[model samples]
Target chain A: MNKRTVLWTAIVLALLALLVLGCVFFGLFEKSVVAKDVDQPLSPEQMKTLAVRGAYVAVAADCYACHTAKGGAPWAGGLPFTTPFGTIYATNISPDKEHGIGNWTRAEFHRAVRDGVGKGDTHLYPAMPYASYRLMTAEDVDAVYAYLMSRPPMKVANKPNDLNFPFNIRRVLTFWNLVNLPADMPPLDAARLEIWNRGRYVVDALGHCGECHTPRNIMQGMKASEYLKGAVLEGVVAPDITKDGLARMGFDPVLLPAFMKSGISAQGAMTNQMFEVVHFSTQYMTGEDLAALSAYLFDLDKLPDKPASPTQPKPVAVAPELATAARGNYLALCSGCHGIEGQGIPHVVVPLSTNASLRLASARNLIHTVLNGIPGQHFPGLERMQPMPGFKDQLDDRQVADLANWLRAEWGGETPSAKAEDVAAIRRDE
Target chain B: MTIALKKLSLTVNGKAVDPVDVPDTMMMQDFLYEYLNLTGARMGCGQGICHACTVIVENDDGTLAEMRTCITGAHWFEGRKVRTIEGHAKRDASGAITQLSPVQQAFIEHFSFQCGYCTPGFVTGATVLLDELKRQPVARADLERAISEALDKHICRCTGYVRYYEAVRDVILNTPGLIKA
Candidate 1:
């Protein structure tokens, strides 16, 4: 070939090599700096405001529930998290220079908090919840960092995370990040109402309720199509708070903020992990924030439908023994609040006929709730809420079993009888 | 590998426990089951749904409340007093359980428990209910409602929840001045 043609071919190949190299570097971007640097020293007044704002943002995000170990110093970490993979302990987020994030620059901290990338370019496991945090605004991230930095740093080293096989490899998270998290926040809907926007920010960004409430795909990423429809969490049913689900449960949307804040309303009391979430997180939230959350959940009523399972299961047949026991119990003990026809008294008691928990396959929650009896007022309006009493003293295990089975059968729609042994097991286990 | 420790001191089942170092992550269930060897508070649903892990806590105002041991930390009970099922019986000089508490006796009479794992929590909860009822006696007409309200929160997969109410009612009816005349 002529000399000119040969040189042109070489140039084209060289350009191609540069392009491939650029893509590879971008793919491994976690190794390089990503956060924008903030080098200015703020005045005391500015620091105070920033710190205070950060505290609010932290509460909005419910950081303490995951970051702080029970009875441990706030943000000192060591909260044991059990995942399908293995146990991964939360890290110390206090401002200790040696053991915590004391030395982290704003840029570095931002990336870690927003992108799930830790110091030294390490990919943080999803347990840190950067996936949801990624939706946060830059200002919100900054305020949270400032608040966290203001905390007294206790020298607590993070326990090494115990994960199995390829999960232990931090690099695998890069792919998961690519599939689940977007690098930039979705464009704002300028036309949306202010409260709707605020609610969206809290539900989709700060609160990260979807992490547990939203059903997961095979890869453990959220199934966005079925957003807020409902999912199982830690062997307990996290009921669908979606507009339709809430409507089905007869939950008053207008009263939701109160319910979120206090764990009680005219409907019923919160139980299981919800009880814990209300106790640990929502209890500390501002009324406005809770209102925003309720707003978002209420607005979800108009979302487009997707292929999804029924929010609850259909009922099965009941055992004669359970039905007989339930009949007697219903007349004597339960009828006061629940009513003889299983029609619950309005504003005072939740109806068993349409309740969500009764239709579930496992009787553990039913047994657990019956044995424990509802106690404590996480919110103010709980005084107006109806009370459920424990029968552990007066009822035999067999009778309790029959009652649960009967409730499921009659009101719950043809449901299977709860075995006495199962009740006995739950009673024994918890 | 060493984690920070905290000092915990509390009265358990009427016995004062000296201050001891406990890991902050140590749950109340672990404290009762492992440290103090008070196994009555069984861990059912570690997340606080099942009241099987419940223990009776006395407030400063002399009111009693029930708490879940599985989710609560041992340190949360520091400087507080609590009672478990193991404490529900009067002991002789030889440390033998001589006489069962009224709640326990009623539970026995009603056959309230099956596996008995959740019995301690129930017993504590019922004991608290009885105390509250004693402080403010309810009208005879309100007796069923009050008893249902007190016991509905405690779960029993056995006995269909009827007998427990019957037993508590029996106690109230038999005990003079428990219900308004």
Candidate 2:
């Protein structure tokens, strides 16, 4: 231990302390707009009223979709959400004191919903969609808190997340929040109608539609650039719902709201996660709320009811490859249910000619659906679609690709050519 | 325009139905019941969902597969060998029924059907399963699953499905070369 050695050690230690302090100081500059106000004690009547309002708010928020596992107890929360990092199980938000948020104060709940900060100041992962929920008003948070607390508690324990190292650390999420979570939603455009503004709030804030619909950046945060242009989630492409995207799909604004209410219409039937969306959330929305949602989603600047051009479709050119074997395949396996010309039997099969999935440029959804056929679905009314059995084992990848290509050309009209590799890829993902 | 007619020929129940001009739009079920008078495959759902209208079509590769007749056009089965419920049993020159096929006998023994509307379809399905197993036998442990997969598509709406499944299982178990060596 010479004087020079001791001097070097002191200098290194001082620099390391400075670096540590600087990192902590920088984290404080994350510009958090955390809501600290808990709801004041309410009268019994006020609490009841708030809880009732909160019930609708909870549906608008669609908490049930993520929280409830298939056939699992409602609000008990054991649904597993898979991500590139790992799988994260949704937490129990029921009134169970031991397992859920029963003991959580209103202030703590507000922070969790609005600020992405949980009990004990631990940062919640973005899977909670608190970034989108950040737009919710303080009163909305308190109302949700009231509603959740009123639910019957279950003793079901929360499943531990299966994230890899570094992601498993809660401290890492604080930094993730610093980079990802915005301070607040942008100010409402003054030019938009009041109804449109209301709709935007329902979609972006309360509904948190962007969480699944928007594309994610390298950090896996929702990209601010691609707001609602659509992205693939849970093996199915969550189709674009942007105004232009909706228009491209021939969405009548008037009909979309009705579709949202019923989850089935001539345009399309909600399946996959969208089915869960309607079952747990959107179906319960009021007519006015749905109208606003449609207005915002469609971004109708002009009159919504623009009639289409009355023109007949020109015949699509079919390739010899598609015409011979693929056409035979369709007639043998598919034509029985879906008519000879893909003009699906009414109340039996959906028309492939006008199917929204076939119209998409990407063959992912169409290929996936063909490989993994839809289950029997019943809407709010007498309308029911029969279960289409999967043809994964019956049809080879080339056959699936050729069939898709032929169908797209004849019915969907010049969509991308689906390849055998795409079918193979989708098969692997599933 | 006049009703278009097309020449059609196919082997049905070991008898080659000659190239008779039947309407191209006619479904196999309609052709079978109206023209041939075989009348075994009954129309149930018309939507092809109810396998009551199923017929066994022999593939070019000699493999057998069940196909719905209610929705498929008659031309789809043209130039192919098809077997209906009537073809399964043995008969004498006088057309008197002599011996029932193993599937039919098993169904009778298990009481697998009541209304018998779906019996043809179930028999067709089980027959295909038997043919498939003969070609490539499954392990005895997987026989139940094979039977279930083979016959589950046919809706009986009677006899709670356990009897049909039991009957299929009994046929597979009793028969040789069905269980893997």
Candidate 3:
């Protein structure tokens, strides 16, 4: 062969050899890391402890929210979560030897739970919230794994995710994780109190409150600038929790913990999605934790000034027939709980006449509450009370309107009365 | 007409009990509430999205775990052992009755429940989480995640998710090294 040909051939072979060596080196390195991380045998006590921590982790991570199809076994998967792109069904993570992650190794489980990588190098969708989970510490991940491993074996198989075209490729998740997920712990602000820091850590990491409350970009990433100012999820609006007085309920930060725990805001009662969250999560939290959260929330400085009050529209006078019926119903049903004079059992039951929530400037709230019973709130230093029964079934539309009108005029002091049409509108909305 | 009944043996709240004849299609939730009088595990949603019906199913090796009883058939629990929230509040060494487990205490201190409908489920789930963690050294993130996971099966319509997270976090943060384990 010619010298030139031989040189070219030699260079080509050298390049090929280098590529092979690089691949092998990477493969070995990956295996070493996996071995270092995987299957670290845990003691039974340790395992049990992990299981407990795992339960808490699971709660914060909201695993069952996306997994566990409606009416299906918890963690058995098959819940169809709809996104802007398409519907995605979460996989079964239960300990079932088949149809679930039961056969997965500790490393495999960790990868799926924290890294969003599934078995056989499959990439799970971001809907799994692994991007946020990626910030979880190794010990936290291990505890979750232990807890999951200890679960009773469920045999339910996971349904395949329905994604369109290129999005369906699982390998793409590695790229997504690389771009969107954080591998290390979140940076702590030294200036903040330990409790506040702790609250921030939980909110940002395992709690992932921002995932729902913060607005998102076109790529579905959270808009860092708009963090926790509130956003919409599943057609439900998560009200801005920022101390934006104009944008939020007009209460000070001191009232936030109580509001969060009780679903009673200074401006109004918790409605829609916020109510659900209060019922599910916040009411159970400690006063100290709530206080810490409130402290952090109060410290937010970007709020706008409160808006000027608008002029009240003309009130619709209550019909005589409706007024008589309302008074009679109040005497029969409500007087037992709330005294005939509108003085509720002190501390035990909220007094209607003086209660700020009941006396809000709109009869809309009173109507809502009377029609749909208010769920109890858990304020610190207060005993938990049974929820008030809704009078929707017993009261006619006109009766509800009359009762709300009377209550607003008599107890609310300044609020306008509700009309029959207003009650009809609320009934229709429900 | 001939009547058919199935006989099974299972451990309930740490005690072994001989199974009586029950319909094959009887729901585990019904069996617990009607037959065993284990009302601690509730039936918030009969379909099982809510973990109100959760119970700790003990394996043969003495290790216990949580399961939802609403959708599970009684036949599936034939040879298993189960513990409910009621079982967690047992007598201590001195034989005096104690009402609060660590999980329960954490819940109460935190004021975790609003309507109290989902509290039992959360308590049961939290107990399992605490048991698994061993030492209570949970970081803030870990604590939040732990509470979230424990509450995944239950739905509360009162307090926003904040209080539940706080209750569990309080227990972990207060208890040294529990979250780390």
Candidate 4:
């Protein structure tokens, strides 16, 4: 062979070897850093205490429902959650030294659980529910950590999250944390009773009930101003638990605890997602806790009444066909629950005549409820009152749109029209 | 396949039974139904999400605690004692098991069940909660929480949650020194 050919081949081999060595070195260095930052060993006694605490925390956190792979080990996480953006998988949290957080230090664990930061400073997607966990006390976090470490180790590697380009950029979460996240505990109201304060802490902090119950801004960050004023999540409408007489099922503060504990209100029983929350979390809370949650929730200032007249009531002359059909449908189906005069069953059904929530808000709830009937309880004493039934199977998307538009126009006075497209979107939710 | 089983002796409902060998993976609910014929704990969601299969596990201390039988394996009860709802009603001086526990009475009085499916779990759970709170009195608000938390595992679809709350509240209020009526 020629000397030139041999020299060129030798150079190529050396370059390839150098590249392979560099890749291996980089991988080892990354893992070592992560291990050094995250892993911390626990004593056996601490493990036992943590196990007990973990059980309670697991219940409190409702972690199993989200983390456990369908029919998998309790905390050996692999649950897939789908969102509008993409699907996210819950990582293995079991005490598996190799696959899970078995190697994570207490501080690293705390950061991941509370602050949503991972080892090597990887940003966890907000889907981790750290926004609510941020409210957890240090001790609570420790107890949960203890429980996780105490569990029998399961070797389950976590699946990668499937978020789109911009969202997959984990570094952007650093900014998301700064602007949207409230990393600190809520300031305690000194004037409130200890029990009431505890309730506030649990609800606002540990329970993070508002994360689901409260409305959100355009960026999906919770709207603090409209906290617990009800929001639509996944597909379920978390009703306004606030004591806006018209918005809530006319539930007074006194009755709110009963509602929380039992998932029933004066007007109707809770169904769907709210039912599960109550069954798992609120129902397990101490009565004082329930009362405190109710007390704090009831005290929020009622939403300011909208002016009777809109400054610019955009006149979308309702299409001739839609107007007639919507009016006819409302009279036939709604008047039974909501009286012909639009004054609903007092305290039993929300009055439509002057209902601010029905009039001014987004038509997502109206469309969804009309399409999918509300599942409710029939507790012993109140067997007669069943929850609202879904009309999805019965009504076309356009019909639901027309009915919702009619309710808003007639009751709320002047609001943006609910297009057929809105109904279609809500129907596709599940 | 000849399965190897472990012999375990434990008191159930205050009655001592002969030790029996059973598979480790068998659920507590199946064990209770097959061996003891104590079928009060109904299986609703086999998954731990619903508490229909709750039974009171008598701790080493005198206190009783609730655990779901469906999800928990029978092997966990190797040396543990348990009290089902069937065991809750006691025999009075008359030598007949005529007296229902306060929780049971309260449930009956308040009409807590509609389909009567989740009642046993609620009853068993409430009994344990009441027993724990007996030593230290709970406030009215605390009573509600105690009851709700106790019965939190159980799911009832019929007769909205109000009646169940009322049933537990009645038991707490009626029990003197626990909570003021």
Best by TM-score: 2
Q: Candidate 2's residue-wise lDDT over B1-181, tens digit each?
A: 4656777899998899999898766788889998899899989998877899988888879999888898777877779999998999999999999999999999999988998989999999999999999999999889888888887778888788999999999998899999997
* Off by more than 4 A, model 2: A1-31, A39-45, A301-316, A324-326, B1-28, B31-37, B57-64, B72-81, B92-96, B129-149, B176-181
Lowest-scoring 10 consecutive residues by lDDT in candidate 2 chain A?
A306-315
Predictions in order: lDDT: 0.74, 0.82, 0.66, 0.69
The runs of at least 3 residues in candidate 4 whose Cα sits more than 4 Å from the true structure, single-residue gaps closed, are A1-43, A50-54, A217-219, A235-237, A243-248, A300-363, A374-390, A401-430, B1-181
Cα-based RMSD of the predictions, in order?
18.6, 4.1, 23.5, 22.7
Model 3, residue A91: what's the lDDT?
81
By lDDT, the best candidate is 2
Over the stretch A98-207, how does candidate 4's per-residue lDDT look in tens digits?
A: 88887887878878877778766777888787877887777777788888787788888888889988888776665556556774775777776665676667677667
Mind sharing the TM-score for model 4? 0.51
**Candidate 2 or 3, higher TM-score?**
2
Candidate with best DockQ: 2
How do these models rank on lDDT, best leading? Answer: 2, 1, 4, 3
| Stretches > 4 Å off in candidate 1 | A1-45, A300-322, A329-430, B1-181
- DockQ of every candidate structure: 0.02, 0.40, 0.01, 0.01
Worst 10 residues of 1 chain A by lDDT: A301-310
Q: Score candidate 4 by lDDT.
A: 0.69
